[model samples]
Target: MKFKITHITTYLFDSEVFLEPHYLRFRPSQTSYVNVSELALTILPQPAGHKMVQDEDNNSVDFCWFEGMTSQLTIKAESVLETKPYNPFNFLIYPQNFNTLPFQYNVLQKKLLFSALEVVPISKVLSDYALSILQRSNFNTIPYLTNLTKQLHDDFSVEYRADGAPFIPDETFQLKRGSCRDLSWMLINVLRQQGLAARFVSGYYYFDMVKPAYELHAWVDVYLPGIGWFGLDPSHGILTGNTHFPIASSAHYEHTMPVSGGIRGSASSKLNTELIIEKL
Candidate 1:
């Protein structure tokens, strides 16, 4: 399947101001599942300079700086991509005695997966909640994760927030409501607590049930000894497939913002965005 995607972001400031180098990760990262045939970006007030750079994960990012003062800025990014069908269950053979709890990673594997395995402290409430799911799944490898993902989707109510960092996992657990990033973060921490390696994922999900619409989305990728890395969307209770086009991924969600930068003025700002995705 081929998908054409457009995303527009507008920033309106109370007063003219200078902008620091802005980072843009609007271009989808090419992977075995998806190919980007064409991509373009438009910026208003014409940047003084801009360059494309690859991050630690090899995700494409645009670094931009503005010359003169401007009270408003607009950015439009469009892309054409081809995605192949994905089978979540298509995985490599597991190492001996590696299918159950207390996963064992070799020295080399541990070093390679360190970032994804970094431990973050969470409240007892969250620890207990995650434990319950593990117990219920009998700690079965694939079933455990699948059930955990689905349970999160079924258990929590989604609260959409267009800006700001996701709620910490403990907060999300207590509130029982959070945005996609919040949920994904919660899941990432939960998996990490059990010695699983997981990382944050940001991208666009093509939804047919809704009109030709698109939005920035968040999910996670877990590292399995045999399978390497695979994605799962706790917010949607599904493994990421052909329809999920990841643009940026990092161990920290803050690094994956579609647009991020510092400004030199004290101007308050308002932001608006529009996204569209259609089948080609």
Candidate 2:
């Protein structure tokens, strides 16, 4: 499936976010600008998941409070993709992001920055459970899984919201249900906890039946021993196939918010959100 996506995030700054220089993993070091691409990419708003000013090289930093972000994405199948079923062994598992950034919760708890998260779920335990799901000796491989990258299809559940409420892990554990981000995060953490590397994916999903062919969604991918990396949507209870177009992924979703960053100067600002995903 092919899609066009629009995402916007606004920041109400008690502070400012300045541009800085730092390293972006997948691009050339000289890359200071992002261009139009149908492929996946990552953009940083604040270095450690908080608002900060950054320089051109993406290195030097200035202290700041608010950051605002917006992103438009075009995701289409790449006929000449860099990764292959056989050669993507390295990409399937989690990349060593430890060097670039620390665990989301650990950094804040240490009081390293103004960054924060309360009731941060301990991820290791969850990642372990997810890996076990993939390695089930009796699990039968879905034949389509092997042909997915080449398939032209779509599979996603109907859109739903969480009542804008947050639940503790124990609640999710007992209920075994939640929103897309919840299930996606839960599955990935379960896999990571087990020593298996996993990452949370965020982007647009579409019901192939939709005329526009896209909508906002979240899911996960885990590394498998025999197959490089495979994706799964625990909410949908199946493996992810090529029909899904991934925009960006990180240890978690905060890294892939539709928009994040701050506008240095503006009249008194207020945040308002609007979203609509239609089949057509």
Candidate 3:
């Protein structure tokens, strides 16, 4: 499948303020299953300096620094890409002994995935909730992940929150509803609780529709020895496939934000975003 996507973000400040250097993670990541044929990024009040670079997580970033004061800032990104279809579950788990739930990674794997494996203190309710899914899946790793993703999707209501940090896992669990990032973050903690190395992923999700409005999507990526990093979307209760175009991923969600920077003045700001995804 081929796609054309346009995403625009604008910030309006009450007064002119010095624009600080910003990191933009808008370029679609080129992966084994996805090809990026074309991509363009536009910034208003033309930046004084700009460079395209890769971050520690291997995400493409547009680093821009501005020199003048401005009352508003605008960024627009456009891309055309093609994705290959493949079975999301085509791979096998490595080291057969690690195919079950509550299994630990080997020494080398553990050292590399240390950050992703760091567990946050979760409430008993959340732990019990994850354990219930584990038991239901008969302590099988694949089934446990599938059931956990499906259960989260079925039991929680998805809310459209354009901005804000993710809510804590326990809070989201108690509320039974959250934005995609909140759910993904919750899922990451849940996986960590089970001794799995999971990280936060931010990207674009293409649903088959007629020029539908879209937003940046969030999901979880679990590291398995043999298959490497695999994506699971609790928001949709499905394994991520070709339609999932990742921009950035990190052990912490904040690091994966599409835009990160600050201003030099205390001017209040209003943010607006528009996204369009079309299938070609």
**How well does each candidate superpose onto the true structure, as a TM-score?**
0.96, 0.45, 0.98
For model 1, the superposed segments whose C-alpha errors exceed 4 Å read: none
Residue 21 lDDT in candidate 1:
82
lDDT of 3: 0.92
lDDT of each: 0.88, 0.39, 0.92
Spell out the clash pairs found in candidate 3.
none
Off by over 4 Å in 2: 1-159, 162-168, 209-215, 263-280
Per-residue lDDT tens digits for candidate 3, residues 1-280, read 8999999999999999999899998999999999999999999979999999989888889999999899999999999999887788889887887788789887888888999999989999899999988998999988888889999999999989999999999999999999999999999998998899999999999886665768899999999878889899999999999999999999989889988999999999999999988888
State residue 189's C-alpha deviation in candidate 1, in Å.
0.6
- Clashing residue pair totals per candidate (backbone < 3 A): 0, 28, 0
**Candidate number with the higher lDDT (1 or 2):** 1
Q: Compared to the true structure, candidate 1 yields what TM-score?
A: 0.96
What is the lDDT for 124 in model 1?
86
Candidate achieving higher TM-score, 1 or 2: 1
lDDT of 1 by residue, 1-280 (tens): 9999999999999999998889988998888889999999999978989999998877899989888889988999999999987888998647845678777778998888888888989988788887888888887778888988999999999777999999888899989999999999999998999998899999999878655545689999988867877889988898888899999998889889998998899999999999999898
